[model samples]
Target chain A: MSRALDRTGIWIGWAFFADLANALALTFGYMFSRPVTMQYPDKEKWLPYSRYRGHHFLKRDDEGEIKCVACELCARICPCYCIEVIPYEDEKGNRHPAKFEIDMARCLFCGLCEDACPADAIALGQQYEFSSFSSRDLVIGRDDLLGKPGKAATGGGVVSARLNTEQDVLVETSEPQGYNWWRNIRRT
Target chain B: MELVVALGLIVFKVALLIAILLLLPLPLTWLERKVAGHMQQRMGPMRVGWHGLLQPVADGIKLLTKEDHIPAEADRFLFKLAPILALAPPFVVFVAVPFGESVSVLGTEITLYVSNMNVALLFVFAVIGIEVYGVIFGGWAANSKYAVLGSLRTCAQMISYEIPMGFAVIGVVMLAQSMSLLEIVRAQADVWNIVYQPVGFFVFFVAGLAESQRIPFDLAEAEGDLGAGFHTEYSGIRFAFFMVSEYAIMLLTSVLAVILFFGGWNGVLVPLPPLLWFVLKVAFFVYVFIWFRFTFPRYRYDQLMAIGWKVLLPLSMANIIITGVAFL
Candidate 1:
C-alpha cells in the first residue's frame, strides 16, 4: 500500500497536482489590480548634480587684452593634442598666441590643461550644451575661449590692480558653468 | 438578459487577465535587472523614474524607435512567427489558472478563469512543453548554423529536463487524485503538497528552471557560442516580443511552482483575503527566480543535458519510488 501510494503520489504531483494548484490559485486570484506606471515626457525630471564639460575659456584683464601669453603649456599638456595655438607680435610688441583652438570633439576633459596653466587664466565651465551637426562648429577658437571677465572692459592699458586676484579673474570671465559636452555623456 | 450579462463578464475577465499577464512581464524584467545589480554590487537602473522603475518603459520606447533588421537568407515567415508562438502559450495557460475561488457576479456564479477545463494539469504541461517550438523555430529560422545548433541543443535540453518535470508532478496528482487544478488546490487545504513530497518539489523546481530556459541552463541563448542565440536575426518589435514572452514564461513557471508545492493561497487564515496570500506566494517565487538567474553562470550545453538526464531524471524516479514505499 505504501509503495503504491508513493508511486501514485509522484505520478499525481508530476502529472496533476502542480497544474491543479496553479489553476485554483489563478482562478480565484483574478482581482484586477491597477498597474503602477509613471507616464514620462510630460514630466520633466531634476538631475542630481551639474554635469557638463565643454571647453575651458580664460579670463582677460581689464585692458581688453587676452590673458593667454602664447605659452604653449595648454597645447603641450593636452592628451588628445586637440588644442592649437598661433603666437604673433602685436603693434605694442607684446607676444601672445594670435589663434588658440581647442577641438571639443577630441577633448577628454582630463583638466590637465587647466592644471598646467601657470597664469591661472583657463578653467572648465559648467556649460554642457555643445551639440553641432559638423566638426567645425565644435572647434572653439581663441575669441570663444577668452570668455567675458567678471567686469566690463574699461580704458585700454589700465593694468588694473584688481586683475591680480585669482577670484577676480574667475569672476570676470565665468558664465555659470560654460559649455561642456564630456560631462553630459558621462553622467550616469 | 442574464445570458448576455454572463457573456459580458467572461469577456471582461479574459481581457483583464491578459492585460495583467502581459503587463506583469515588464516589471519582472525590471526586477530581474535590479536584483542582478544588487547581487553584483551595483545599483541597477537608479536613474530613470525613481529607482529605475521606468527603465522598462524607456527600453520599450528605445526599441520601438530603433531600426528593424532581417537577415537576407532567413525565412521571414517563420522568423516572424516564432516570437508570436513563444509569447502566446503562457498567455493561453493563464486562462485556466484560478486566482480566487468562485464569486457571485451579477447573480450568476461565474468562474474567474477564461476557460475551465477538467484536465487543466495536462493542458498546462502540454502548453508549456510546446514552448520548445518557439526556441527551435527562433534558432532554425535565423538561417545561421549557430542558430540551428542552438535550437537543437535547446530541444535536447528541454526534452531531458521535462522528463523529471513530468515525474515530479505525478506525485502531486497521486495525492490529489484529480486533474482539475481547483480540486488539487482544495485537496491541499489541510496538508500542503510540499510537506508530503519534498523530493518531488525539489525535482520540479529544478525542472521548472530548465523549462523556462533560465540561468545555468541558459546555454540555448549563450551569447558567446550563439551570438544572441536563436533570436539573433530578429530586430525591432520582433525582438521585444521575444523578450516579453521569455519573461512571461518565467512568471508562469514561478506561479506554477507556488501552486504545486507551496500551498497556493492556502497558507494562513488572514483577515486581508485569500488572494493576497496567493499573490505574496507568487511574488516570493518570482524573486527567487530572479535571484537564481543573477547568481549563477550558464551551464555548459553538455553538462546541462547530463544534469537533466542523469541527475534529475534518476533522482525524480527514486523520489517517486521512495515516497511510494513510505506511503505503503
Candidate 2:
C-alpha cells in the first residue's frame, strides 16, 4: 500500500509536471525554429543533381548534324524496349537515324542506354518535368529530341563523343554546368 | 412587439454563431495539415490557393459530389441519423460560451455570446454527453465487428474520462462559488485558476483530450487496428460531417479551457480589445492541440483506461479537497 502511494505521488507530482514542461519547451522551440520545407513552386523549385536521369534525348554535333549514326546500340541496351531507331544512309553516304522514337511512358529513366552508346549520341537529360495528358504525347520523336536549344540543353546529346574526336568542340560550348535546369523549368 | 424583437435578436445571434462554427473548421483543417507538414519538414497541400488556403473548399466540393454508400446489412435509419447526431452537439454547446464581455452598440449593451444561461456549465456538459451517442450509433449501425468494437471502446473511454473531467470542473466551480461559465471567468480576475488549481487543470486537459478522442486517446479510431474505426462504412459528406464535428469539439474544448483556467478575455495591459485577447488565447490552445497530435503517439487501450481511472480520477479528487481546505 505504501509502495502504491509512493508510485501515485511520483506520477501525479513529478511525472506530470516534467512531461508538461518538456512538451511546452519542445513546442516553443519548434515554433520559433525555421521550417525545413522548401515550399516548392511557391518559393523555388528544388533541383536534383546534374547526373539525375530524366528524359531521353538525341545529341547533335558542332555542325548541328544528328550525331546518332543509327548504331542500334541504345535500342539494344534499353531494358524496357522503349527506344526505336532505324538507320538509313544519307546523300553524303553518312549513317544517320531516319526514325528515332523514345516512348517516355516505357522509358524507365535508367542510364544503361546512356552508358552503352558507343557514339555518345543518346543521353538521359536532366529535364524531369515531362508530365503529359495523353500516352501518345509522351512518345518523343527524333525532331522533338533535337529541338532543345543547344546551349541550354544537357545530357540528351553528345556531351562526350568517344569515336567522333569532337572533344575540342564539346569544350568550346558551355557544358550544362549545374543542377539549375529544374528551377528554370518551374518558372516557365 | 417587444417579444417579437427579442425573438428576432435571438434568431440573429443563433444564425451568426452557427455560421462561425460551420466556417471555422475549414481554415482549422488547413492549419492542422500545415502544422503537421511543417513539423515533419514538408509543405502540405499547396496547390489550390496561396499555400493551399482553399484546400478545404475543394475538399468540401469533392465530398459533396462523391457517392454516399451504406452497407447492405446496416441499420439504415441509425446510419443516416448518426452524422447529424455527431455534428449538432458541439454547436449546441457553443451557445453557452461567452466570447467577450458585454459591449455597447447603438446605445444598448449586447453580450457577444449567443446565449448565457445561469447553468451554462451544466448545459455544456449535457450537450457534450450527447456526442458519444452519435459515435456509438454509427459504430453499431455499421454492422461490422470492428465498428462495434470501436464504438464500445469510445463509449467506455468517454464515460471513464468524464468522471475526472466533471470532478475537475467541480473544483473550478467550488473556487468560483458558481456554475455559470461567466462567473467562473470573473472569479479568475485577480489571478487565473491555473495558479491555484494546477492539478485540476492538468486533469481537465487530459480528460478533455480523451472526450474529444484525439491522439494518445484515439483508440476509438485507431486506423491501424480498426480501419477507420466507427466510421469505416461512412463516406462522402457524412464522413466530412464527422470530421467537421471533431474539429468543432476541439475548438470548444480549448475555449472552455481558456474560460476555466487562463482568465478568458483578461490580458495584461494590452491595447487590443478583450474579444481579440480571448480569440488569441483560444488560438494558442488550438495550436497546442495540433502540436500535441503530432508530438505524441497513441496510447494503448488498456493504458488509456488505467490513466483515466487510476491517475486522473484520484488526482482530481485530491485537488478538490485541497482547494476546499485552502479556501477554508
The lDDT values for all models are 0.74, 0.83
Per-residue CA lDDT of candidate 1, range A1-112, in tens?
Answer: 9999988888888665565455434422321222122211122211112333334666676797877777889899999999898989889888788888889988898888
lDDT of 2 by residue, B218-327 (tens): 99899889878788889999999899899999999899999999999888676688899899999998998888887778999999999999999999999989988988
Q: Using DockQ, give the best candidate's number.
A: 2
lDDT of 1 by residue, B62-134 (tens): 8888788878898888888888888888888888777767667578676656666788889998887777888
lDDT of 2 by residue, A53-168 (tens): 66667778999899999999889989999999998999999999999999999888888888998888887665556677799998888999876423234423323322333124
Interface RMSD computed for candidate 1 is what? 12.3
**Proportion of true contacts reproduced by candidate 1:** 0.00
TM-score of each: 0.73, 0.86
Best by TM-score: 2
Give the per-residue Cα lDDT of candidate 1 at A30: 25
- Model 2 iRMSD vs. native: 2.4
Candidate 1 residue B306 C-alpha distance from true site, Å = 1.6
